[model samples]
Target chain A: MAAAQDTGGEAAAGKWYTAAKATYTTLIDTGHAISSAYQLVNVPSGVWIDERGRIVRPSETAAPKNQELKIGGKTINTQGDAYVAALRDWVAKGESSEFVMSDAEYRRRVKERSPREREADACFKLAVALHDRGREDEARQWWLRAQTLSPDNWNYHRQDWSFTSEAGKKWMDKFQKTTTDYYPKLELKEKP
Target chain B: MVNRRLLLFGGATALTGAPQARATVLYGDREVELTTSRVEKGDLWIPFGDLPGINEFSIKPQGACRADICIPLPKELKRKGWLNLSGFARKVKQAVVNDGALWSFGEIPTLRGGFPESRLAPDFAVKDRKGDTVRLTDFRGRKILLLTWASW
Candidate 1:
């Protein structure tokens, strides 16, 4: 098993990595590069790769258990223990793993981005370049632009929110605006 | 046109004394001095922490993004916290070259080919807790579960 952090510096990532105590390969991606590569827009996403280097499963929310949490008085869906159980099944069963998605299903699930998403990506890159130069104001401009381009990408908003003190208020406002459909329902086929 | 060229050429020389000019980056007529960390495969690598502007587009899931624009990059180009300038330039269709001390990027290209489709996961290298380099290929023969999560 391999784990990578999305945002935050090494210090922040280290704090959790040290606590996990997992014997797997733990990595810190300060730049969020893994998020981009794996098409993960949020945290706790997972990809399953078989022994032949083929991606049996694409990025999806992977939770070990179901937990009920109230945020802003709203109940957020965190049900995915089935995914965890499926993972265990895959580890033991290989190709015959019931959790292994078919190639056609994988292709269908991996949605393609629109042209606007591509443009937002470019703007975000430019924004990062400017921000690194200690040009916060300029960076904010691009950040705003990026938000406008990819409104659904919570990471972009959350990462920027981390820089400001009003992150909680801002996130609450955003969260309130989201509908109940915000979290995609987990779809797992029953074991045959 | 002449004034722009002068701005480009003059800025290059005037920046010689700036400490950040240790690694010069030229993008079109705008040349900026950036403190670069390392050079790999002849391309300059910019640390993500040092370049916050990249956050606008350096998302892994959506590819490099900027102001509502995103271009899927070959998964092979990503290396931990650093973005390969050459690989990025190629994905965005920009020309980038390293001349020993400086890195120059030409005009941004209009045409872009999205990331290539492949059944195999792109190989990348990252550092472990012990600071030892770990490559994806190291687990070539093993079934690996690559998971991404964060404390926040």
Candidate 2:
């Protein structure tokens, strides 16, 4: 998924897809709809679904390759190898995969969407609609409202700040001031 | 343009029992205007008759409903052929934002009745990099590693 503002005609996304020689379809999300739909807090998240469309594994930080990045003196946990290995295991073993989360475990891991978060979603989507109609100021207003309602949603903050001229400073300031992992640490292990 | 007017909500109610020609409804990504328009008491009153078109809700014998989920509205709310959309939304815990003539509604909470038990990876449709529409259901027969990424 190309999760960002519906701009640039997704040229960068297209270029990256070509350079990587990727075969999978890359869908563009302008309104952060996928984030809202899947209850994702940030990008590079993944959800594993079975052939029957049931979510075998809930949404979690998904990085395909191991890489450590130093940002605002914090390390983004990219559990690439273990995650990918587990994914491959699922592909090979199907429902018998030890990595596949059981329904009980899935229930425990996935949190229910709060009403405030729902409202935040509304605001975020409204911002997208206004932006589509060339109403930048109104869009910004709703985007800020969305972030305010769901402060933990880094995608809301990151996406909003990325549009401004002082994006780096804004992000660093917020990053340093806040106390939360860029991506929540996932326990990558076989389901017992 | 002579009769078209913009109605905004700012705390106080503004019900004119008026047919607001410019009133627009944005539900999710689609701005659906497939039905007649009416604004009442600072709320976008989606008439009971127009519910199916606006939000897929239909006035059934039990109540206003979509699929099997029904929200039984109060008598006062279902008046003058229009359902008190604000009241109904509040009852359903649907987030609503009225910006001038535009009203944006969030996902109706009723649809997500059961939590993890009903956790089907929602089927979503969006434009592929090639400008063609793609959907998650398109890959139903295969295992999907649905990942969200960005160039940012």
Number of the top-ranking candidate, with lDDT as the measure: 2
Candidate 1 C-alpha lDDT tens digits along A150-171: 8987767776777778988998
TM-score, cand. 1 vs. native: 0.65
- CAPRI category for model 1: acceptable
Listed for each candidate, the true contacts retained, as a fraction, are 0.54, 0.72
Q: Model 2 over residues A89-123: C-alpha lDDT tens digits?
A: 99999988888786777788887788899999888
Identify the leading candidate in terms of DockQ. Answer: 2
Per-model TM-score versus the true fold:
0.65, 0.89
Docking quality of model 2: it rates as medium
Quick one: best TM-score, which candidate?
2
| Tens digit of per-residue lDDT, candidate 2, span B79-102 | 556678877888888999966667
Off by over 4 Å in 2: A1-12, A190-192, B1-15
Instruction: Assess the local accuracy of residue A27 in candidate 1 as a C-alpha lDDT between 0 and 100.
Output: 82
